[model samples]
Target: MQTQIKKWGNSAVVRLPATMLAQLNLSVGSPVDLKTEGDRLVIEPSLNREYKLSDLLEGITPDNLHESIDWGEAVGREVAA
Candidate 1:
């Protein structure tokens, strides 16, 4: 994806096509993180970053006993089953 960097008003910007943006799961105001992963520059939607469920649940207590199942696999099984 060789995109030309062009001048945007006062600063330079790369125009991401709508298709490309959507493929990358990006939207007009979606947050993104920029970092050099290994040797390549990686640009991805910020929300795609992985966070532990425990981190998100923080102080919340599970009301039921079945909530302890690993959600990713559980969802996969539920969908596949």
Candidate 2:
């Protein structure tokens, strides 16, 4: 597919078709990496991965559990539980 570069404020922008974005699993506000290789512009998705809280908690076990530290008596109007 051929696309033309258009002026967007002070930057040049190229609009990708919805079909192309859907095929690449990209959406609005998705992060992408852009580079130039031998006069060719390469656009690719960023490598950053999003992690879920439940998935992260699954890695913790009794073997690697840590004990809470004991802080001394609180000063300066601190509430005691």
Candidate 3:
């Protein structure tokens, strides 16, 4: 289905048809990556960049709950001091 391009203030906006929107799984406020290929333009969804566990774990410190352990009397002795 073909859609019409209307004048929006200082720029022209293309109102995508309902069929094309449904086929492309696009909705309002969705980010689109537009590029020019030869004489035509291509529009698609942008790649979502996500952070890793290292990013989320920044400035986090490990607990030292076992700092009171004692192993001086016997080989297998691990009594908490």
Best by lDDT: 2
> Which parts of model 2 are misplaced by more than 4 Å?
49-81
**Deviation (Å) of 2 in candidate 2:** 0.3
TM-score of each: 0.45, 0.59, 0.52
> Candidate 2 residues 1-81, lDDT tens each?
999999999999999999999999999898999999999999999998899999989999999888989888788678756
TM-score of predicted structure 1: 0.45
Candidate 3 whole-model C-alpha lDDT, 0 to 1: 0.77
The Cα error of candidate 1 at residue 35, in Å, is 1.8
| lDDT score for residue 2 of model 1 | 91
**In model 2, which range of ten residues has the least summed lDDT?**
72-81
- Model 1 C-alpha lDDT versus the unseen true structure: 0.75
Weakest 10 consecutive residues of candidate 1 by summed lDDT: 64-73
Candidate 3 on 2-75: residue-level lDDT in tens? 66779999998888876777888888778999899999878888879797999867745576333566546755
The TM-score obtained by model 3 is 0.52
In the predicted model 1, the residue pairs found to clash are none
Candidate 1's C-alpha runs over 4 A off are 37-39, 48-81
Quote the positional error of residue 32 for candidate 3 in Å.
0.2
